[model samples]
Target: MLRALIYCLAPPPPTVNLVSNKSNVVRGKTVPNGTVSIKINAKVYMGRSDAKGLFNIKITTLAAGTRLYVTVTDKYGYTSKERVVIVVDRIPPAPPTVDSITSKSKVITGKAEANATVIAYVGSQKIGSAKADKYGKYTIKITPKKSGTSIKVVAVDGSGNQSVGKIVKVRP
Candidate 1:
């Protein structure tokens, strides 16, 4: 008499989760489509954002301290930006680092030689970018999708130097 033995092997499905800094109601409704892409170490994971800005992507394999990159695009203009240094481990990643910001009505004088670039961010989401001149002057016209939002700005030099500034509150 002869007997045979059988073995079973299969890979598990990936797991996904949504991440955000703050939760609030916009225009009398909740924003749910703020999801971002997550990467494990150096591998890209399949994920997507929901209508409420929530995302939960699963991976067949996962490792600790995986470096993650999150990016969201402006629905109107389709301009996209990626946040650097986003890490994913057993714990969630820290908030985005804000450098500097200024919100004055007389900052821009309708000049054409402005060379300075203004980068704006609300929490971890990048809202817009602007340019200034040699006099360290810039103007950014921001129309927030939601109410009661705040943003930060960073002044970057041509030599790759970043100067920290104050945070500005936005009113709808």
Candidate 2:
């Protein structure tokens, strides 16, 4: 009597977390002891999954919007499909610089990161928001406030990172 053996053709793809510009390593999960490969900017990095099926690969820090491709190969020489990840910007943009805010003024002018969204707040209430131009200039329209009213402004980058607030006091 003769017996036939069936072999698995490929391993399952690895699961990776969301990567960001602040990340210096790529971490993911695959088959236990499987070989893991990461490709970023056409450069390939190799690593191995631990007994718990978790793997981490150290590589050069990548900028926001960079793309990483990952794959896994099991001990049976079966390779998985490629996984794609995009790095997000985790670093906040610089605080916006605002012009004078007077009691009679209806517009707020500022400079911030190019294409970032600038938001103005009075206490905890949002007043106005605008997107900065290519030159990092923005103007937000808001209702006039009384003298000594404090207006706080912040810049939010494309990746949703928000900077510390810049406070301006409304003058008479």
Candidate 3:
């Protein structure tokens, strides 16, 4: 007699969803179709506009805070207007000039000592806060509800100026 065996295989790879939102808009009245070009990270990905003044493009993979450029061409054969510094990252880039951030024992440190007065935002949602100390230091602690979470931070000065920094990746 002969013996038989059965085996099971893992599932296929998951699909990557492309999420797009209105990055920026150029103001004009007589803007014609094929007059606009949407550039992501300094690369022209989509050109021309539809009847509704809307254009859609898919991005396979993009890091957080990817800067975007939108340009509009005038009927007079000239670059009518251009919008720069538009970011495509779901969460905006965190503020720069962070004195330092330290993580320990599943708890992050350095928000309070940085003199941070407001909570940082990642797409309109506050993730963390850091308040400045007498020595101009701030401390912030971040603990994600789930593992492999990505967050952004922005710091504001007393003069109301904002600075952006890199995205913070949390490891489980």
Candidate 4:
């Protein structure tokens, strides 16, 4: 006599949002009473889902662009397909530092987070944009404006996070 037992595959994959590097917890949903596991670098973390299929697991801080692998295992011991999550940068760079600008000046120079994009604006109109070098130095060419005119400079990181704007006044 041949006996056959049917068993379902692993629990459905969990759902999670695109997380930031600053995130310290991973939350998601899967099969009720199932187990969820996360792998980051060489570390693995495990947690059980609630009756509502929700799970929250704490993790150490991750650097931007780090990858996390998640899986859910049903009571039958079957594991679901692996899910990949990537960490992003959510922290903005510091405001740019601007050198003194005179009405006769033809360029704006400053330092910001390395490789960040620097944008200069006069009111709502953008004057110019430049990318900071590895040394955090940048220069933007612009036509000389009237003395006392105010220009705003901001630094944007690779993740599109903008820093606070710095105000620069055109000197006589």
Candidate 5:
């Protein structure tokens, strides 16, 4: 009598985590070292995964928001699922510019990222909120306070990213 044994074999799918940093940089790593590539409009940036399957590639300054496609090729010639990385305008709109501050009227005008949320602050108290128009202009009304009181206007993007505060000394 003769008997035969059968065996089954297959490679596991690799693991990958794509991350974006505060500096607007994206980095990713794979479970197993693999080759990676980032596709731009008509260009490709390639990098080889390290022993730990980690790699980073800095995207050159983009003119505007861009969509990035990344893929990793494993040692076994298997490619990872494609990932789409959306690089929004990470750059917080410029710090709000205090164009005018009328203490008596309790109104403040400023310039910020167009359509950004602008808040008028009195110390820790939030007094007024306005959305900058397309031209990055905004006029917010708040309550009048003591003279010499310092008020600040801060702009925040849709992503909840804050901009530097524009401080003004109220001459109430």
Candidate 6:
């Protein structure tokens, strides 16, 4: 007597579609049978597509002009592709320097990168702004709340890139 056996198996899943947006976000479409995983800097982030085959992946902001390696993999062990994205930033101006107080004056002067924009902030309020000269010199008139008032100054480049903030204390 001869015996016959029957076996059934499913075919491989569909390929994943991926796209990276300008705002540091990645979108993709995946198969319903599996979730999508993104790897960056040795860290793996996992997610799945919806019924409409849509997915959104959010990535952290990186330093200006930096690069991040990213890849996408589906549940069925299918990987779409590896992508390298450079962090896009305006590259803020250098920190500004507050000149020594030779006298008590409302005009605050500082040295910054040439052609930079200097903005003074007292707490959360913006006191004023000044444009740096060709020599990297900037001056802005700020109303002194009082002696010992803490102030923060930031420089902005023409491309809207902002520099690291510099802190200075007001003294009489």
Q: Tell me, by TM-score, which candidate is best.
A: 4
Model 1 clash count equals 22
| lDDT, candidate 1, 1-172, per-residue tens | 1222111111111122322222111111112443344444566644345675455555443333333454443233232344433222332222223323334322212222235456667788876766666654556665533444566666554433344633555434
80-166 per-residue lDDT for model 4 (tens digits): 878999999999999999999999999999899999999999999999999999999999999999999999999999999999999
Model 1 TM-score relative to the real fold? 0.32
List candidate 2 segments past 4 Å from native: 1-8
> Tens digit of lDDT per residue, candidate 6, span 1-172?
1222111122233333333223456565554534656665666666676776566767664455555544444454555444555555545668999874323657779899899899989899998999999999999986655767778889997768788888877777
Clashing pairs in 5: none
Per-prediction TM-score: 0.32, 0.89, 0.33, 0.91, 0.77, 0.47
Find the 10 residues in a row with the least total lDDT in model 2: 1-10
Which candidate has the highest lDDT of all? 2
- Quote the lDDT for 51 in model 5: 93
Indicate whether candidate 1 or candidate 6 has the larger lDDT. 6
Residue 22 accuracy (lDDT) in model 1: 24
Report the CA-based lDDT of candidate 1 relative to the real structure.
0.41
Please list the residue runs of candidate 3 whose C-alpha ends up more than 4 Å from where it truly belongs after superposition: 1-107, 111-114, 141-143
**Each model's C-alpha lDDT?**
0.41, 0.92, 0.46, 0.91, 0.72, 0.66
Which one wins by TM-score: 2 or 4? Answer: 4
Clash pairs, model 2 backbone:
none
Between prediction 2 and prediction 5, the one with superior lDDT is: 2
What lDDT tens digits, residue by residue, belong to model 5 across residues 117-154? Answer: 99988889899999999999998977776778788889
- Model 4 clashing residue pairs (backbone): none
TM-score, predicted candidate 2 vs. hidden true structure: 0.89
What TM-score does prediction 4 earn? 0.91
